[model samples]
Every structure is written in C-alpha cells, then in structure tokens.
Target: MGTMAELFAGLLEGVSEAVAESTSLQGNHLLELAVPDDAWRQVLCVTYRLERRADVPANSFRLSAQASTPLPFLVQVMTEDQQLINQVDFNGGPPAAAISGSLTSYNGQILHIRMSLDGNPLVFHLDLGQPASAALSGRLLAFTLASRPLPATPENEQWPRSVTRQAFVLGYEDPVTGQITPPCRTMPPALSSSRVRQAFLDLTNLGIRSPKVFPLLSVPTDGAAAQAFRDALGNVDTDAVVAEMHQGRQLTATRTGSGAYTFRFVPDARYTGPRLLLVETYQLTSVPLSYGPGRVIKTFTLLPGERTTMRVSSYRRSSQSIQSTSSVLDSTSDESEREFEQAVTAEQGNSAESSKSFEYNAQASASAKGSWGWGSASASVSGGISGSNSSARQEFAKNLTSAVGKNAARASARREVTVDTSMDMKLEEGEESAVERTIENINTSRTLNFLFRQMNQEYAAVLHLVDVRVAFFSGHSESREEVPLAELDSLLDRVLNVPRTAEVRRQILDLVGATRDLTGNTHPGFVRTQAPDGTELAPAVDPTYTSDYTTPDGRTITLPGIVTAAERHVMRTDGVTVDAFLGEGQGLDAYSTGLQEQALRAQAADNLLKEREADRLQIALEIARDGDQKRAEAFRTLFMPTQIVNQIDHAAVNTAPVNGKPSS
Candidate 1:
C-alpha cells in the first residue's frame, strides 16, 4: 500500500521523458506554458482511462472521464476565462459529463479542443512537457480525496502506510490578481510510501549480538611464551581486563562457530605482543531520484521487517532579534564613630570661649616719735618748782627732790603730740565674650532634574521641586565669671557705694543665632534677613504633551501610547521588506517572541549534540587508524625464527642451485 500522491507520481514517472522523445522525433517546437507535464498526466489519469491505440486519428484524442473515491472527495472545475464550472462536493461521486471532441494540435506540446459539456461548448488547452507559469491560467479541474490507513501487511511491518489523494495543480495564476504564484514544488506533498525511509529507525532497534573477533593471544600450546602469557593472565583479574571499542562504521570480526583456530610453534619462537587491529568498513545510505516537479523517490535498502518512514518538509526564512542584559550593585559604609565625630564637628564650630573677672585690695599704716613730749614735761616741772619758792627755807631741800622728780616727770611728761596716717589701695577688672556659628551650603538641582527628565517612561510628564528650601545653622556660646572677693560684701558695698563704682562695673554678654552678617561692623538697625542662596520654580508641561490627542474614531491617545506606536512603526518599517509588506499573508502570531525563544534554545541544543557526535566519530576514526599502525609496527619489531632466518639468507643468493640446475 502507498499514498495516493506516491502512486500517481510513480505512475507518471517516465511521462515527461516519453513526451520529450515523441516531440523530438516529430521535429516540433514545444510551447512554454504555466502547467507542469506531470500535472497533466495526473489529471488525465484520474479523470479518464488512457491507453495507446492505433485506431485513434493522428495527433488527436477523445475526451471522457469517470472518477470515484471511497472517502469524501473534493472536485473543482474552472473555465479558460477563469469562470468556475461544475464543482462536485466530497462524499458523492461526480456526475459523468458526456464529452466528445478531437484534440487539435496548435504546436508541438500545446493542444486545443472544443468539447460539448452537458450543452455548452467549452474550450480546453493542454501544454504537454513544457515550462509553465507558477499558476496556470488555462482551465483547471481537480479531484482530492482524504487519506486512508492501509491494512496490516508484511511490507509495513516496521512502519505504517496510508493512501492519500495525489497532489497536482492545473493552473498557477492567482485567481484575484491573475498573476502566477510560486511553484507548487516548494510545498510539501503527501507522505511517502518508500520502504527505505525506515532504515535509521530500524538501526536504532538493531543490536550487535555477540560480536566476535580473532583471539588476541595466539602461541604454542606448551612453551615459555605461552606459559608467560598464561602467568600474566593469571596475575590480572580476567573480568577487570574488559575491552570496549566503539566504531562509527561496521566492525569486522570472526563469526562465532565459523571455523577452527590454527597455530604452529618451533624453537626460539618470539612471542607476539599486544597490538591494535584495523578493518575497512562500509555503510548503507540513501540517494534521491527526482523524475518530475514535486516527485521524488529515495532509493535505499534495509534489513528484513524494516519499512520506510514518510517525511514532509516546508522551508521558509525568518529572523528576529533577542536582547539579554546584566546588572550589578555596589554598597559602601563607614564606621559610626567617625560619622558621629564629623557630625559633631559640623554642628559645633571650634573657637575660643568667653571669660570675665574682678579684683580689689586696700592697706593703712601709722608711726610717732616721743622725744619732743619728754622735753615739754621737763619744762613744766621746772615752772612748778619756781612757783613753790615762797617757802624758801624748805625749798632748797625740796628743790633737789623736786629737781629729781621734775627731771623724771619731764622725761615722762614729755609726751609728744605727733600723729601720722598712710593708706594703699589696688583694684582689677576684666571681661570677655564670644559668639561662634557655622553655615553649610549644598546644591542638588542637577541630580533632581536628570531624574525627572531621563528615568521615567518614554513620554514622561514634567516633574520638579517647587517652593523648597533647606537651611541649617550650628552655633556655640560660652560665658565665664570669677568672683573670688564676693564673700567680702562690706568692702564690696563700700567700694560700690562710690560715685564711679557703678560706671566701672564689668559686664559680659554672649548671643548665638543665625546671622547673615559675617562681620559685626554692620549697624545695629540693619536688617538681618537676606536673600536665599538658591530657588527652584515649578515645572511646566513638556511641549510633546500636545502630540497626545483623541482620534476621530473615539480612541483616546496618550503620550506614552504615541511614543510606543512610533517606535513600533519604525522597527517594523526597517525590518520588513517592501514585497513582504505589500504581499498578502496571515498574521505573524505563530512567530511570536515566546516561540522564537523556544526555537533558539532547541537550535542551540541541536548544535551542541552535533558537535559532540562529530568529536566522537573523529575519536573513533583516530583509534582505528592508530590500531592499524600499531599492528604494523608490532610485526616489524618481532624477531624471525632461526629457520625462517636461514631460509631468507639462502633465498638472497643470486644463483641458487635447484634440482642440480641454475634457477633464475
């Protein structure tokens, strides 16, 4: 059993060659047309029964047809002017149309005729064995039947077969454009029915059962060489000495139970060492035979019970681009102690502090001399003695005593009325005050603008900071006072009670705040408020916003949508060809990104497998060649037996005597 396409193609295999020979012998010029020669044969065969007959008129033939099928069939008919005629539906046989006419030859291959179909006169032209347009313009009539599975049979033991309707086209022109389409040969036909196609499949199941080869070790039954070989074998584990060889081609070895082994031993026989062996190999392959357009037969041979595998193929070229990306991130940190120190330094400026102090001291001293006072007392005593002279007689004696007493009294009474006074005073006062502050300036306008403009969607909206200001102030203030004499309230009060004491008092003051004036030289009435270091305005809508609008069809348009559409349009315009854009076709849903990714992965896997297979085959070939070389080298190194050595010397003689005669 075979597919309908295969049967028809095989039946018309030699028709083109036959027609060519006939036309050449007749010495006629062939006409180029749109229909294939095999197409003509297929149509003629299914539509009518053809046979060689001498009774027919020269270069003429009658037309008639009766076609049927067990399964549903589709029939279509078109006139020469592209008008459809009778179209029979599948599941019902076509009504037999009574057609009688004589084919009149217009050229070597082009033949025309007027047939009476039902009642109308229809014209038909057949271009035999000539080039045709991709789509034939002449009348087209075809019958198609669904494929049916074949019954069980020995020929299909390994692979099943099915019978399908043959594939053929009478016209090649597009019905709408009246232009020729691509050749039908580019399309895949029904499955093949050839037996050779299953060879690879059968090989997968076939195993190498008990492959044998000549003994690796051959020597005398009983000798030192044989004993040595035996001892070597005894020392090694027999199971461990496994030899596994993989070859790409068939291996040659002695068949099991084929014949007896042979050997001969003589004295001083050198043992043969281990060596590799090489064998020439062969394989079975396929060769394709193409008889006509869309007709191919692959010739091959396979083992018993193996059948061909049907294959269908369609080829097309398509390409796309894939993108892959890699990303990385880096993070860094500093010690917390260092960060704290920096913050403290920035907040508090390092500067000298303020101080104030007050000090006061006083001292008084007095001294007197008594020498003048003693002299005055002596004069008073003398006056007192003169007043007492009235009593003269006793006065002389009293005068002496009085003189002594007056002298003592004078010395004692000489009290000096001298007085002296001195005073010393010291006063000290000090005051100090200071104000320290820090101001920091920073700008981030560029970074904010870049983020708003570049990192959003393709058609992002305008964004910016508005009415935003940042200010920081760090300050430090210190005041110091020393009052060691504060406990001396009475002295302090006495000193402070003076008229200039209040005016001489020390006062220190410190003020810490944010001030625009770096120098205190400014007037006290001057305003401290100053202009900001920087300002940021609100963001306005981008000009591209106007491009977004509503369509007349009521579809709302957005900036992002517009941008996406523009990009997609550009990509498609650049990637697609003009012909492809203008030509008719189905949507490219089948070639989506997901499908493309899967296909690429599969292709990569296939390539890797192919490379591995190639490497394995190469290694096998090298092993085979090395085996052969090693065998030859081993034989060269072997020492010949004494008998063979002596024979070689005798044979080397120029003129050796044989049977008492000189032999040349």
Candidate 2:
C-alpha cells in the first residue's frame, strides 16, 4: 500500500476472494433444490429457423451443448407441422432411435444432434439435468446441462446451425456391370406360418390339393419362426413340399406404383461432404415346416457402396400349370334264335300175274261246220262212234248189246268181243325207300357283346419373368433448401412408389391397333407393299369390303399373283384329283410329310426343265455339226464342176458302157 498500484492490486485480490466464495455458495444452493415428495423438474423448449446457406442441398442441422455431468434425459424433435421425429443418443452416446426406453448418460460429455431440416421451424425439447433426493443417501444429487438460445428476427429463429443434407439409399451394386441396382419397389406378400396354416386347412377341406404356391424355396433357416411350419403340417416332407411349390406353378402379382430416379453432381458451396449410399442385396429362399413352406429373405450387410448405377432383381411376374382329363365308354349286346324240320318218303315195287282178258270195241265220230256271210252260207255234218270190250264174255256181250240198241236199230250189231290171258310175266323192282328228317323243331341262338373304355390326362406348366425394371425414367431430384427430418420419410416413400402408367399406356396403344386391324380400317393407303424386284407396289385399291379377309400367309403373295394362281389351279383339267381323309396325331404328321414331298416334287420339276434344256443343247450341237458338214460338201460339189464331170466319165468307163452301150 505504499503506492497507487499496490493499493489497486490489494483491492482486486480481496474482491476476487469474495466473488469465489459467493459462487460456491450459489452452486451448493442449487444442489439442494431437491425436497422429499417434491423433486425439482424443468423443461426447456427451443425453436430454430433454418436459412439457406448456399444454392445446394441444405437440409441438415446440428444441435450441440455441453453436459456438466452424466444424467437421465429425453430429447424430442418436431417440425412446423408438429410431426414428431424421435432422435436419441442417450446422453451423448450412440444413437438409439430404434429402442424405446429411457436414456442415461454414463459420464459428463458433449451433447450434440444432427438431423435433416426443412423450410419450416424446428422445435426441440430437452427434459434433463434436474436434482432429486437419493433414496439411500437421503441427500440431493444433481446432473445438469444448461443451454440458451440466441435471438433472431423470427420468433422461432435461434442460433443453431444448419448445413447440407446427407441422405442414404439402399440398393444393389452389380459386380459385372459396375452399377448400383435399387431395391424393388414392390415385394411379394409375406408368407407367415399362420397364413400357411390357414391355406393348408382350406386346401384340405376343399379337396383341391392340386393348388400350389409359386416361387417358393425349400431350405432351412435360423429362428423359431422357421420351425413354426412343422407344427402345422404333419408327416409330410417339408423340404420336398417347399421345393415343389415353384416347380411348374404360376402366380399373378401386381407391381406397386413408383417413380424413376437418377443422381447428378454439381459443385455447391454449401455441400461439405458426399451423401451416403448403401448398396445392399438379398436372395429369397424357402424354409419348409409342418404346415407348409415359408419365404426367407437373406441379406448381405458387408457389401461396399461405391457404384453409380444399380439394377433390381425380381421374381417371376406370372406362372401357370394346366391339368386335364378325358374319358369315354362304349358298350353293345345282341341275341338271336332259329328252328327248322323236314321229312320225305318214297316206295317202288314190281309184280307178275296171269288173268283172262275180254275186250269190246265201239267207235263213233261226228263233225259239223257252218259258215255264214252276207251273201253265202255253207254247212257240213259227220258222226262216228267206237267202243272197246273186256275179256269176260258176259260183260262184253252186255256192253255190245247196249251199244247196238242205242247206236241204231239198223246198226246190225257191229260189236266185236275178244278175250286173252297170259300165263307168265317177269318184273324187277326194289322193295321200298323212305327218308325222314325231323328238323321241324330246329332252333338256333346267338349272343354278342362289345365294350370300349378310354381315359386321357394331360398336364402342362410355364413360368417366365423379366428382371425388375424401372417404371419411371426421370432424373433424381434434390431440394435447394433444407428439408425437415420429419419429412424425409415421405421423400423416401415417393422414391419407392412404382406407377403402372407406362405399362397402361402401352396396353392402350396395342388395343387401339388391334381394334383398327379387326375393323379393316388399318389405313390401307398407308400399307406399303413391295414387288419381287424390290420396287414398291402400287397403292391399295379402294377399300373393298369383300369377305376375303387376309389369311396368315396373305402377306406372302401379291394380290394379282395369288388371284391368277388360284384361277389357274381351278381351271386345271388334266391333273389327277385325289381326296384323302386324315385323322389326328400320326395323320397330321403324314400330312406334313406329304406337303414336304409335294415341295420336293416341285423342285424336281424345276430340275427337269434344266435337264431338258441341257439335252436340247446337246442335240442342237450335233445337228449343227452335221448341217455344217453337209453344207461344206454341197459347196465343194457346186464350186468344183470339173471334178463332177471327171467322176461321171470314170464311172461310165468302169461300167462297160452300162449294157455295152455308152449312150449319151
């Protein structure tokens, strides 16, 4: 205190000592805030308004504070729309957003939060750092952290900072293509044990055991859920059942709606680091149990995510299995009966005897004729009688006397009687012959029967699918301003949604084209055709609504050519026409063979033409040589007349004047 500097220093030391004592006392007082049945509790709420820091994705924000000591705490984040986004680190530890439990800090640490942001204000609630009485110690204990907000123009604006947003995408990166494949927007309906049990029960009750689920795998997997199927199905091969599900089976599934997305990069002052993209991939398998097979989705978690393009793997879209049966029965029967009978008898004999004979003869004759005409008439009459007598004299005389008396009183008895007797006679003959056939009760019976039975069964199945494809083909999108963490879920939903608009549009166009074709309104003027020489054919004639619709091979022939060919075929008269009947199966094969044979015949005909031309050429060459030789001989004979005269004279001299006189 001897000088002014000493005096000022001494005063400052005293003041500093007093101030330190007061701060200690205040801290002790705060620690004593806990009272029995009335512990101290406090809630802190803060609102933050995020502003665009640059022209980039600025949807991320950070909340940070310093904890004086470890404590039990709860923190909540919300958006302007009051949408709750749960975020927790358990007092500055690892995040535990998926866990639903109270959070406790282990030791004093720095409290921090990082999350997505949006255009709206963010509200944060901190419920921590309050002193309460210890049950055993009967004394107050405190764990506290203090934070204060900075003022801004807006009521919700605070000093919390925001930066470029970071997003994570899950997909598969193709090893071969060096591209990323996004997850499928739609997944098959989950098959659970309960559902399987229900389905099995239904099948059993309905007696429709042929029904099957498709694309089902047959494998074992970890977890009690996999074992649940066994309890439902008894005495059946679980693995076999699951494996058979996808064999020759069909299913119908619809894809949910989604949009196409792409990603591009542009330099942004606000973007500090690249966003995260996880390329995850998985395979679907089946696990067999008692009741039925179940689906198991296996995923690989350690795959790297450094690709730019991705593809999606998917199951088949549709499948089918067809089964059919046919049967036939035919039967016939017949019965019949008949009967007949016959008989015949004959006799022959010869005998000889002697006897006296008497004979009386008488004869009479009469004739009369008359003719009349207009101018002439003629008549004539004649009569005569004749008689024979027996050998007995009395009988002969009686007959003769009666005859004479009747014939005429002037008959003068012109009767003649004679008797004759034979003493010996010879005869040769058989005794008797008889034949009897008692077929009078003839009877015959017949029976016939025929039966035919047949049965046919058929089964067929087919399944096909294309890999998962993008329904939308647009580019990726990003907001320039911050997007709230609460709204991030919606964005992801949008990305996963797949729409049927593109497919529907294609189907509509196809249907329209088909309709036009059916109506014969396919714009005939626009239908172009080409000739064999590759020149464009003339435009189609006026639309003639003839019954002559186009056949499958109609396009193969020109209109005029086909017409002429048909006409020629119709006009043919010399060719043999054969009508054949063909049944199914082998008959069809034989028919096809016949058609091939016909084509071969046509080819042979063409070859025959070439052969004929060759033969004609050979014949023509020979004829030309002969004609050339003959022409040369004729020219020699005509040009050399002296040779002809000399030849004639020599011939005459050698011939001895042809009958001793060389005349003329």
Best by TM-score: 2
Write one digit per residue (lDDT tens) for candidate 1, span 1-664. Answer: 2243355457656366432110000000000111111211121112211223354444333232333444333333333444333344444456433222222322232333233322223333433322212112132323222222111111211111113212222122233333221111111111011211232122223311221111122222445434443343344322222212111111111111112222221111111111101000101011112221121212222222322332211111111011000000000011211122223222223211000000000000010100000000111111232222212212222222232223222222221111111111122243111121221112211110100000000111111101111110000000101121122222223212244222212100000011111121212111112224535322211222222323232333332101111110000001110010111332236456467679789999999999987986676577577788665444434522233234745655434346658866
Q: In terms of TM-score, how similar is model 1 to the real structure?
A: 0.13
Model 1: residue 215 alpha-carbon error in angstroms: 69
| Model 2 C-alpha lDDT per residue in residues 355-384, reported as the tens digit of each score | 000000000001010000000001101111
TM-scores, one per candidate? 0.13, 0.15
Determine the backbone clash count of candidate 2: 54
Every candidate's CA RMSD: 67.0, 60.8
Q: How high is the lDDT of residue 287 in model 2?
A: 14
lDDT at 301, model 2 = 15
Q: How many backbone clashes does candidate 1 have?
A: 19
